[model samples]
Target: MEERKDINRLKVVLAEKKRTNKWLAETLGKDQATVSKWCTNTSQPSLEMLMRIAEALEVDMKDLLWPLKQQ
Candidate 1:
């Protein structure tokens, strides 16, 4: 199996939560481009940032991370 390369589930979770990148950026006081990079998995957020993201998204921190393996 090809090990999954993507690190975060930000994009998927955003979609599930019906949130737009723009909304997240505005809510987090972040750059929209930065949020886009995160959603595309082109970059990652610091643990602190991730925690903040979880709060803004109203989701658990674990939900922002990809599972080791999905059955």
Candidate 2:
């Protein structure tokens, strides 16, 4: 059996919230480039940072993640 990794859905959530990477960057005290990386899924935020982002975006942690596929 192959193991599957869950996908990141941060960019979609940000768009649904009508927010920008710059706004998230300011909210988290991070650089826009870093936020851009996260939004693009070029890099992922640490679990701790993910929690902070959820708080900043006023969203549930699960909101940042894509739902896992059922076998």
Candidate 3:
């Protein structure tokens, strides 16, 4: 079986921002479980949702995504 990759950096960003998944969920009016999924990389948010997340987090959209290449 193929290994799963962590694409979104939600967990790290949340930690850096001192925010919790539940707080984000409530802010977005979404279910906590869904926010947990996005944080764990078990699933990803849609582009539109990503925009909302960025807006709520006060960060750029690209900040939520894991960089494909390291500098």
**What are the per-residue Cα lDDT tens digits for candidate 3 across 1-71?**
99878889899889989999999999999999999999988899999999999999998989899654676
> Residue 14 of candidate 1: its Cα lDDT?
93
Best by TM-score: 3
- The candidate with the higher TM-score, 1 or 2, is 1
For each candidate in the order shown, give its overall lDDT on alpha carbons: 0.92, 0.87, 0.92
Question: What TM-score do all the candidates reach, one by one?
Answer: 0.87, 0.81, 0.88
Clashing pairs in 1: none
Model 3: lDDT equals: 0.92
- For model 1, residues 11-38, the per-residue Cα lDDT tens digits are 9989989999999999999999999999
lDDT of 2 by residue, 14-55 (tens): 998999999999999999999998888788999999999999
Candidate 1 Cα deviation (angstroms), residue 58: 0.9
lDDT of 1 at 10: 97
Local error of candidate 2 at residue 20 (angstroms): 0.4
Output the better candidate (2/3) by lDDT. Answer: 3
The deviation in Å at residue 4 for candidate 1 is 6.4
Residue pairs of candidate 3 with colliding backbone atoms: none
